[model samples]
Target chain A: MALKFKTPMLDELEKGPWPSFVTDVKRMAARKPACEDWLGLMEMSYEHKEGHWKHGGIVGVFGYGGGVIGRYCDRPDLFPNVAHFHTMRVNQPASKFYNTDVLRKLCDMWDRRGSGLTNMHGSTGDIILLGTTTDQLEPVFYELTHDFGMDLGGSGSNLRTPEGCVGMARCEWSCIDTQALIYDLTMEYQDALHRPMFPYKFKFKASGCACDCVAAIARADCSIIGTWRDNIRIDQEAVRAYANGELVPQAGAHGSEKYKLDIKAEVVDLCPTRCMEWDGKNLKIWDEDCTRCMHCIRVMPRALRPGLDTGATILVGAKAPILEGAQLSSVVIPFMKMEPPYEEFKGFVEKMWDLWMEEGKNRERLGELIQRMGLREFLKACELTPDPRMVNTPRFNPYIFYDPAEVPGGWERDLKDFRSRHQA
Target chain B: MSEEAKARIIEWVKQQKKTKHYFNDLCKAVPEIKMMQAKKIINELVNEGRLKYWSSGSTTMYMLPGQDDVAKEEKGMN
Candidate 1:
């Protein structure tokens, strides 16, 4: 039966050097009728050149609005086996850590009840249990929540699964407790997860620092990244040692990468802010002019450490296009202290939701709403003041409309006050 | 697949006369009924309006609309 099934659209991938997902689906098609239908649907979709799964339909566990995506073959009579093959999404454990025992139990339950197909985790960070009928929805929900001690994740147009990088749990340079914040937000906004009242989907992703390991700035509607406002703590002694090349060692010595530091033209000359000064004997940085690009830190990790004035930087407008091109989130808030309860952070998120719900068109993202209605109108509606930190470069504040006669003192002072108040 | 079972199940449902039951629950009450036979019979009855179906969450319940007002006796119902 391996060669019995035919698909031309999927064969296109096998021709390229890159390994493809079609190969995996084809293997499953040999035994499972659902997989045959799955392949057929994909080939049909590829031929049509846009996804046929329109997304919204009334299907999920009771009391939940989002998560289950009910997909049917566009030509259903041709593929009857997949007519009611809905996808169930389960909330994953924090930081994606799971015991092998728990995973076994989940797989066993799915095998008994569902189509025996699953995507271990979806891109949105939820366990996607694919293919089931409406009859299986509640019982599957009961199996996960009651038997396995798990809860349903977000779905529909509400808050999506909040994804967090393994922060203080694994990395030393983590600026905030990303896992804790994500967990807290998930718990606090459980209703938002279950209820489908929003205009469109909203995503939250956290990265420990500007490294953005999760690409939250490009993928998340609300991007939270850990950062510091004060001077970068530097060990001058380590810098001098590295500069003199004392740390340089042989390849297999103690399993450490050989360290060679040549201070000729790298650090000071390439500093984006030009705030670094390296005299014959000393190294210094004017922290005020720094925008925290993480370039210098990446260059000399042994010498410099993150500052004590730590918080998260909030950015908005990240999304894939519906009306425009994909965009990275623009900086909005410079420094917000990372703490529990997160009243201020949560409030600001709710405010954004309120604005989006009121003005957004069907299936419009928060980023698109900001795009249609200018960033100024969004800020004004949310009651957040613009800050200098929000600017990626000079002349970036869209609200600063200069009048030549009033510019020097009045407008500049107003703009400066607005920025400083928000930053402070 | 048994016409006798299908006719008996429809008769049994009609005998209830004033009660509404979900498909699974109605099937469970009858000891000799096969699930596949019951589902097909229910689908036919529903299409002919002799039986009507509505969903409460994921469960689909069936009943006769004329007998749906068993709750009319409760004047205080929301």
Candidate 2:
């Protein structure tokens, strides 16, 4: 009545403290043929002492070069039932917002045309439908995109998926409208997403604030983090309320002073820029030095609030690794206006893509290319004027100067000139 | 160290014929060439792009360029 396969080696993985993936797959294998295939592959991998599946073959829906990853079993003669297990990526909704009925319909469609096993949302923010043959790919694509109103997400290299956090829609601390921006970018870059023509994959992630709930800075090739340029609004009354402290029962049961007013030590002492100061009554921030790291906002959320003047800080050249080591996105454009249509953001991304295309080696990521050349070269090519905010790490070497003309005694003269023009 | 030793090392390396030879192996073949001298010669050749050095697992071996057909089997996604 149902497909069955033996997995002795897979069972061996179920032991110990951690809950095993084999057990999870077994639960899915009850009715799903795709799960059976996935399980069979895993078990075969253990038996053969290597992975049996080979990725990447010319399998895709018409008019799209990507959105699908083809996987085939090398030991097809032994396990013919689980030979072809291609994966299809359905473009995800911004902020992962989905109704119960929409999910049910999606599952039903997958069951009818392809596999029954699905990863609701994958790492790339796509509805990943696992295990389907080449014959089913077109029908599945047609029904998903044309009938159910869903588009295919990227797979190969041009661009992976663009992800965003639930910003102003659901979160209070959200400095910008992240969902709207992500949706606009996704729609505009649909061609780039579906085309496999880049030297390597590129990803975009958005975070509401420097709390980085979505880990945009560490993960995405382009990190669009919401921030405020103006001073953080501080409520002195609330600050006093938190700083005054509350009496609490000790760990051994007596109410104690061990947990006294330690806000100064915890919050004030931890500020990297030493912008925060508590002079017995008031807590204030020297706004100029505040890097918008969200430390103060998080430490005293009730007292410190994000400024109303919000935009996004754009970072680039982040990725896991390929040739070079993993890198966090370097701050490029510190603050850009975040509004609808996102023309400036879109243009900047186009410039980056064009440069990478012109110069990037095969399988070379943006970070690797930038590492081989220099960040200055990229900025100059993009017509970006370097700013103090753009420096992620403190440029320590005296030899390395941003402006060649401002070398030797010229820096002192430049500061004098700046003070005379503005501070004077 | 000397020009004669550098020339000898380069000639021996070029005679490797699509096969990769390690620093130790090169020293053994050119017994007169010291380990440090062999290393210096290899580094110079590598910098000039005349020789290609690839790390296979933990061992790094050097061979002339255009001998990728032999190197390809061992070379993963570096």
lDDT of 2 at A362: 58
Q: Write the per-residue lDDT of candidate 2 for residues A222-296, one digit (tens) a residue.
A: 999999999899888877766666333122233434344456786778888888888868997899888888887
Candidate 2 docking quality: incorrect, acceptable, medium or high: incorrect
Q: How accurate is candidate 1 locally (lDDT)?
A: 0.72
lDDT of 2 by residue, B10-34 (tens): 7877776646665455555557654
Instruction: List CA RMSD, all candidates.
Output: 14.0, 13.9
Candidate 1: chain B TM-score equals: 0.58
The C-alpha TM-scores of every prediction are: 0.73, 0.76
Local distance difference test, each candidate: 0.72, 0.74
Chain A alone, TM-score for each of the models? 0.84, 0.88
Report the number of clashing residue pairs per model. 3, 0
Best by TM-score: 2
lDDT of 1 by residue, B1-78 (tens): 545655665677777754656455556445565544455555566556566543222223456645544223112221
Which lDDT tens digits does candidate 1 get at residues A150-199? 88777655678899888879876789899999999899988667654455
Q: Report residue A373 deviation for candidate 2 (angstroms).
A: 1.3
Candidate 2 collision pairs: none
